[model samples]
Target: MRFATVEEPDGTVRCGVVESGVEGESLLRLPAGTTVLDLIQAGELHAAGERAQAADDAVPLAGLRLLPPLDPPTVRDFVAFEEHVEGVVQSVSGGAGVVPEWYEAPTFYFTNPYALVGAHDDVAVPPGSGLFDFELEVACVVGRDAASPTPDEVDIVGYTILNDWSARDLQRREMKVNLGPAKGKDSATTLGPWLVTADELLPYRDAEGFLALDMRVAVNGVEIGQDLLSNMGWPFEELVAYAGRGTRVRAGDVLGSGTCGNGGCLAELWGRRGAQDPPPLRPGGVVEMTVEGIGTIRNTVVAGVELPPVRPARVRPRTRKRTS
Candidate 1:
C-alpha cells in the first residue's frame, strides 16, 4: 500500500494512506506524528486497507501539500552501483580506470534532511550552478536499529524514490582538495510521492521480478536514461549488510541505492564527456525519474542567485613529491 505525508488546508501535516477510486478525491489525514515510518515500525500496515475503507473523512489529495514520506532519523546515500561508480571514475580520471579503494567497501555520503522536498515540488538550482544534474535512485527506510545486523536481520521498512540533485561545477572545484562533494550537494534532495512498504515489494526482490521492472528518466518529455532494475550488481540486501557492518542503523534512517547504471543525467546524455562538454541542465527545464511498480517524481528547475565563495584552509607546503 502507498502511504504519504500531507499538509492540510489549515497548514497542519499528517500521514495518510493513498486511497484511490473514492468519489471526491482526498488524502486521508491521520493524526500528527503518524508518519509512514511509524506505521511500518509499529507493524500497523496489515490493517491499513480495513482502516482506510472504514474511515469517512479524507482531505482532498489535490489540495494538500505532500512532504517526504518518512522523517528519517539519519540519511545516508550509498554509491553501490558499479556502473555509476565506474562512470564517475571515468569522468574524473578521463578513462575507464578503477579506484582501488572503491572495491574494498561501499562508499556513502550524508545529505541534509532539511533539504528534502516532496514529490511534485519545485527543485531550485543552487546559485551560480551551471551544471545541474539528477541521480535516479531507490532509498530504503530502516525499521529498527541494529549495530551489526546480519543480512537476514536487516529490516527494510519501505522504499521510495530519491533525486540526488547535483551541482557539477561546485563538485569539481571542491573535490580537487580530496575531501568531498560536500557543500556542492547541500542545496536539495527530493524524496517521495509515497513510500511503498517492503512486504508489498517482496516479489520484486527475486530474479524474475527484477527482470520485469524498467526504470527510466526523462528531461522535458525527452527520454534520457532507461534500464531494467536487474542491472544492479549489488541488491538492497547486500547494501544493507555492507552498511550494517559495525555501524548502527536506526529506524527511519534512509539508505539510498545510489544512481542506477546509465541512470544519471551525465551518463544518459554525454557518456565520458568532460566538464567543457558536460550536458548541463538549465533553469526552466523539468526532470522526471520513474521506476516500475513505484511511481514518478517530477521537478522543475528554478535558477538561484550566486553564493559567496567558500574560504579554503591554509596547508603546509610539501618538501618533496612522495612516490608510492
Candidate 2:
C-alpha cells in the first residue's frame, strides 16, 4: 500500500494513503499523530481499502496537506552508487576514483529531520547558491530497533523518494576549510509523495528486481537524468547490514541511497567541464523527481533570505591522554 503524511484544510498533519491517480484526491489522509511506522506496526494498512471507501470522519486526500511520511529516528545518506561516487570524485580530484576506505564501511551523514518537505512543496534556493542541484535517491525507513540485526531481522517498513538538494557554490567554499558539505547540504532535503510498503513491492525484490525500476528527473519539462535502480553498485540489504554494525538503528530511522549516476543537477553535470552555467533551479522554476512504482515529487524553486548565523560548535577538551 502507498502511504503519505498529509495536512487538512484546517492545517493538521496526519498519515494516510495515496488513494487516487497521481493527481486527483491524491492522499487518503490518516488521523493526526498516526506515524508512517505506526501504520506498519499496527497493520492498519491491511484495512486501507475499506477505510478509503468508508467515510467515518477520517480526513480525505483532497483536503489535507502532505508532509514527509515519517518522524525519522535518524537520517543518513549513503554513497552506494558507484557512478555517482565516481562522478563526484572526478569532479573534486580531477581523476579516476576508487571507493574510499570510509565508504567501504558504509559512511553516512546526519541531516535535519525538521527541514524535510513533502510532495509539491516549494523549495527555497538559499542565497549565494548560484548552482543549486538535485540528487535523486530512494530512501529506506527502518521499522525496528536493532543494534546489530542479522540480515533477516532487518525490516524496511517502506520506501520514499528523497531529493538531497545541494548548493554547489556554498559546498565548494566550505570544503576549503575541510569541514563540510555541511551547511550547504543542511539547508534543504525533500522527501515523499508517499511511502510504498514491502508487500506492495514484493514483485520487484528479485535478483533482477533492482534493475526493473526506472528513475528520472526533469526541469520544467526537459529531462536531465534517467537510469534504472539496477545500476546501483551496492544493494539495499548490504547497506542496512553495514549501517547496523556497532550502531543502534531504531524504528523510523532513514537510509538514503545517494544520487544516481547522471542524477546530479545541471551544475554538477556541466560545471566540472569548466562551463559557467548559472543555477539550474531558480525562483518560479519547477523540478520533478520520479521513481517507477513509487511516484513523483514536484517542487517549485523560491528565492531565500539569509538565515541566522550558525553558532560555532562547542569542543570539549580531552579529559584523558592516550596511553599509546
Candidate 3:
C-alpha cells in the first residue's frame, strides 16, 4: 500500500492511503490526528489501512499538498554504493578507491531530521554555498521497534526517494577539520511523493536478496544520473541492523542508501568535469529523482539567507621564560 500525508484546503494535514482509480487518483483519508507515523508505531498498519479504505469522503490526489510520508525519529544515511564512494573519495582525498573500513562496515552518519521537506516543497540553498549539489538516493523506513536488531528483525515498512541536498564548498571546508559535514548538510533534505510498501517491491528482489530497481535523477528536463539498486554493497537490512548495534531502532527510524553511481552528485561530477565544480544550482532550478517501485519527488531550489563569515579566536603569543 502507498501512504501519504497531505494538506487539506482548510490548512489541516491528514494521513491517507493513496489509491489509483479508473478515473484518476484519490486518497482514502484516515481519522483525524492519526498519521502514517502513528499507524507504524501502533503496529496496526494492516488493520488500520483496511479501515481507512472502507471509509467514505475521499479526496482527489491532485488538489492536496503532499508532505513527507513521515518525519522519522532519527535519520541515518549510509554509503552503500561502492562506485559513488570511490568517486567521491577520489574527488575529495585524491584517493583511488574506498577506505578499508568502508568495506568492513556500513558507514553512516546522523542527519537533521527537522530539516526534511516533502515532494513539492522548495529547497533553500544554504547561505554562502555556491557549489550546492544533490545526492540521489533511496531510503528505507523502519516499521517496528527493536533493540540490537538482527537482519530478520529489520522490519522495513516502506521506501521513498531521497535527495540529500548538499553544499559541497562548505562540506569541503569543514571535512578538512576532520570532525564534521554538519552545517554543510543540515540545511535541507527532501523525501517523498509517497511511501511504497516492501511487499509491493517483492518482484524486484533478486536471488541474492538485493533489489534490482532502476534509480535515476534529472535536473530540469535532462537526465543526470542512473544506476540500479542492486549495485549496493550493503543492503537495507544490514544497514538497519548495524544502526541498531546498541541503541533501539524505533518505528520511525530512516536508513538511507547513500548516493548511487557515476552522476549521483556534483562531487562525483567534479572528477568527470576535470577537477572543477559542477554548475551550482540556482533559484528556479528543478530536481527530480525516481526509483522504480516507489514514486518520483520533484523540488525547486530557492534563495536562502546569506551566512556570516566564520568567527576567529584571538591568538596571543606567549613570551618564553628565561631558561638561564
lDDT of 2: 0.73
Which predicted model would earn the best TM-score? Answer: 3
Query: In model 1, which range of ten residues has the least summed lDDT?
Result: 268-277
TM-score of every prediction relative to native:
0.87, 0.84, 0.94
Question: Where in model 2 is the C-alpha error above 4 Å?
Answer: 21-23, 40-63, 92-96, 99-103, 208-211, 276-279, 307-324
After superposing candidate 3 on the true structure, give the runs of residues whose Cα lies further than 4 Å from its correct spot.
316-324
Candidate 1 residues 215-270, lDDT tens each? 78888888877776666656666677777788787777888888877746574334
Ranking by TM-score: 3, 1, 2
- lDDT measured at residue 157 in model 1 versus the true structure, 0 to 100: 74
Residue pairs clashing in model 1 are 26-60, 27-59
Candidate 1 TM-score, C-alpha based: 0.87
| Per-model lDDT | 0.75, 0.73, 0.87
What candidate 1 gets wrong by more than 4 Å, as runs, is 22-26, 40-50, 93-95, 207-212, 267-278, 312-324
Clashes of 3: 0
Candidate 3 per-residue C-alpha lDDT over 191-236 given as tens digits, one digit per residue, 9 for 90 to 100: 8888888899999999887999999888888888899998999779
Worst 10 residues of 2 by lDDT: 270-279
